[model samples]
Target: TAHRWIGRAYFFAGVFPAGIAVLGVAPLSSTGFVSQVGNTMLAVLWLATSIAGYRMARQRRFVEHRRWMIRSFALTTSIVLNRAWLILFVILLLPHVDTTYGGDQDAMIRAAAGASAWMSWVVNLLVAEWWLERGDARRRTHRTGQAADRRDAA
Candidate 1:
């Protein structure tokens, strides 16, 4: 179905950014050739997922289509959350934690990065769900109005 394809597309879109971030965060020299190969394979998978989703959307599968699109949106949003968390961590948590040996900075940064990523995903998901719900409500209202009008004419 078209919806299914769209969902696939969205799913893949999210995977690409997450994959890149994960790979980038890993120490390149530490992993060796195997890491490089793994990264490449991840990239390939992201591409394939996105293409499939696109194809499904093109087929007019709105249900699956919206699902994937929402997923993609969520995945792309991790950067925003990551940055926000970093700023907050620096402003609020940094001063409270001891900076001896740079341990505090490292810990704060990691925590912020993780929290931000999670927050972004959650916020995006909620927003997408709300929009979809509102749309469905409007459609129902419209249908009801039309039925009332028809009844009046009859």
Candidate 2:
């Protein structure tokens, strides 16, 4: 299927290059040292989640694979969230720029970008995990209910 093929291509193209870029380019980033570290951590988690998903699929652990893949997808989409967070942080920090950052716009932005970068991926991954857990709980509850019904009928 085209969707699967596209996903495979993304895994190769998007995931690998992102990991490589963070390792090779993050150190050279002007966003400050802490942001660089955060970027590196995000990259590492992205690659790790992707690899874990692929391995789980190969090992026939479909549920684990699904969870990992969802996590990977959430991380991948964090770029979009990062942009949104950047905007939100910037707007919220505007009034504080003069007071909190000593009138340094660059410093304020650096703070905003750093916070957004970390929050984007971390929050996304957390939400994904929470959603997946809720789904699993719901399925377990439904299964238990069905089992009870069958026993009652017998």
Candidate 3:
């Protein structure tokens, strides 16, 4: 469908290019190995999920496609959530924490940063899966009720 094409286009033209730029410009020395690896892992997940979603759709496995697309979107959101979480960390911990970035960052700060980077997408996907399962349960209940009603009427 048109939407799928648009998503693919955005991924290739916008997200992919921007990520490559970030990788190119990011100072690995400042980000540290864990953070850098997290970034790369997220980028790969985003691209791979997008492609998987597209392939699922092509095969008419709409349920699987929806799940994959949800995952892809969640991964894409990680970039935005990463910044938001960092800001929140600063706001809440400013009294006891240093907000500066780079090699001199404390162990707690680096741990939080790396965890946030990974959790941004991981949490989103988990939440999405929960929501989807809840929705499906509701639909099944509704259908069961409808069937029961029909049988009673007969």
Name the candidate that leads on lDDT: 2
Q: Score candidate 3 by TM-score against the native.
A: 0.74
Ranking 1 against 2 by lDDT, winner: 2
Global lDDT scores for all candidate models: 0.57, 0.88, 0.73
Most TM-score-accurate candidate: 2
Native RMSD of candidate 2 (Å): 1.6
Residue 95 shift from truth in candidate 3, angstroms: 3.6
Candidate 2 runs further than 4 Å off: 1-4
Q: List candidate 3 segments past 4 Å from native.
A: 15-29, 98-108
lDDT of 2 by residue, 19-125 (tens): 77877886777988767887888889999999898788778798898899999999999989999999999999999987999999999989998988889999999
Given candidate 1, what's the lDDT at residue 83?
65
Estimate, for each residue in 1-154, the C-alpha lDDT of model 1 and write its tens digit.
Answer: 7856655444555565666666565345233443344434434444454555466677877677666555445445645664675577567766755753265666665555444445545566578678778888999999999999999999
Report the error of model 3 at residue 134, Å: 2.0
